[model samples]
Target: MQLDATDLKILQQLQADGRISNQELADKVFLSPSSCLRRVRMLEEAGIIHHYCAVIDAAAVGLEVDAFVQVTMRRDVEQWHENFSQALQQWPEVIGSYIITGDANYLLRVRARNLKHYSTFVLERLYKTTGVLDIRSNIVLQTLKDTQQIATSLLVAE
Candidate 1:
């Protein structure tokens, strides 16, 4: 809905720390706790605040490798798209998937334990999926920056 300066502030604070208590969030936004909670609830109701989750370290949790996979569909059919999308939803290795432009029809962010595991996933699972024409993967050498935070600059004019 209509987000004012205070709403933007609330969003920025929450983006930084989703675990912040309602009272703490209110203090940061300089609003009463009840008022701040109401705004948060409203944001959630309006779909601006989707869900809060913990961000875990992939490497620490046995997912040491990050891969960007480009998938090309065999046919430009509606059924093919639907089937592939559903398949991706069930696959745990895929953290993010986008129907993109350019040569590749879909781009997937995947995590694996190592290169051998990634190879097995590619050869056994992704390649065997229906309507998969070609699959290209780019392994991340070094991750400079990775965060789920939404840019607040878009909501504010400089």
Candidate 2:
């Protein structure tokens, strides 16, 4: 969809607070509640707005450490990629995975209770997963910034 200023405004507002009522959204965008509702629905149908989700704190649930693991495979075969993706998808501990641009074939973000838990993940779970030839990791010392929102300034530029 061709997102104009109004669409971008709606998206920016929604990005800040998805739980915002249509009535409040209408006020922000200078649209009627019904119009805001219609626009949001249209954005969803057009795939401009993909989905909404809650961001949870890992430390609150016995997850004390965050890890970034870089995995390299022997080969970039389709079956190998599929097998790895499927395996990671089934493991809830593997919070996020990306086929990224770098020396590593895949990048994974994992949260564990502690170093011992991470050892189990690497030695037991990760080693057991198929097609993993080499793995490297950098433990997150501190999180300076984290966000789920895409910058409106970037996305709205035409």
Candidate 3:
């Protein structure tokens, strides 16, 4: 859908606070409650607004270790890429995974309770996975910024 300035304003408000009431959202966006609801529904139907989720703090839930794992696959193994992708879905420790242009075939963001827990995952699970050639891991020391919000201001330019 082609979004106007009003649509952009609505998106900006929603991105900042997903839980905002329709009445409050309407007030902020200068639309009536029904109009705001209709526009939001349209956005959802268009797949612009994918879904809502709560961002949980990993440390608060006893997850302290965060590591970026670079995995290189054995090129000779049949269906190695597909098998590795499937394996990632089964491992809860792997919070995020991506195929990237680099020395590694895949990059994985893994979270664990501690160093021992992280080590166990690397040794028992990741190492044992078939077609895995080389594994490199860099533990995150600190997180400076973490956000899922998109800059609606930039989108308005398009």
Candidate 4:
């Protein structure tokens, strides 16, 4: 959907605070509450605003380790891709998985309690998977930046 200045403003505010009341959002964007609510509903219906979620601290929830895993497949077949993707979706430790370019066929972002837990995930789950040929993992030491918000400035031209 084509987004005008108001829509962009609404998106920006919602990204910053999804829990903001409709009246508050309207006041911020200089729109009537009814108009603002209508626009938001439109955005949601058009699939622009996919969903709202809370950002929780992984460490606070007993998940201390974050790792990026590069996976290579033995064969570049449709079945292999499907099988791997299905397996990934079922694995709770795997938070994010991407079919990337370059050397690796797939990249996975995983979170675990500790090193031993990560090792078990690799050895028992990933290694035993039929289509998985090789796996390389790099554990994260310190996270500098992590966000789900999109940069609206780039999309909205001045």
Count steric clashes of candidate 3. 0
Ten-residue region with minimum lDDT total, candidate 1: 149-158
Off-target runs (Cα >4 Å) in candidate 2 are 76-78
Poorly placed runs, candidate 4 (over 4 Å): 76-78
lDDT for each residue of candidate 3 in 89-126, tens digit (9 for 90 to 100): 99999999999898999999999999999999999999
Model 2 worst lDDT window (10 residues): 73-82
Error of 3 at 70 (Å): 1.0
The total number of steric clashes, by the backbone 3 Å criterion, in model 1 comes to 0
Cα-based lDDT for every prediction: 0.93, 0.89, 0.94, 0.93
TM-score of 2: 0.92
Error of 3 at 16 (Å): 1.4
Off by over 4 Å in 1: 76-78
Q: Return the lDDT, model 4, position 100.
A: 95
My TM-score estimates for the predictions, one after another, are 0.95, 0.92, 0.95, 0.96
C-alpha RMSD of candidate 3: 1.2
How well is each residue in 57-100 modelled by candidate 2, as lDDT tens digits? 88887899899999988685558888998888877778889999
Per-residue lDDT of candidate 4, residues 14-107 (tens digit): 9999999999999999999999999999999999999999988999999999999999998955599888888888899999999999888999
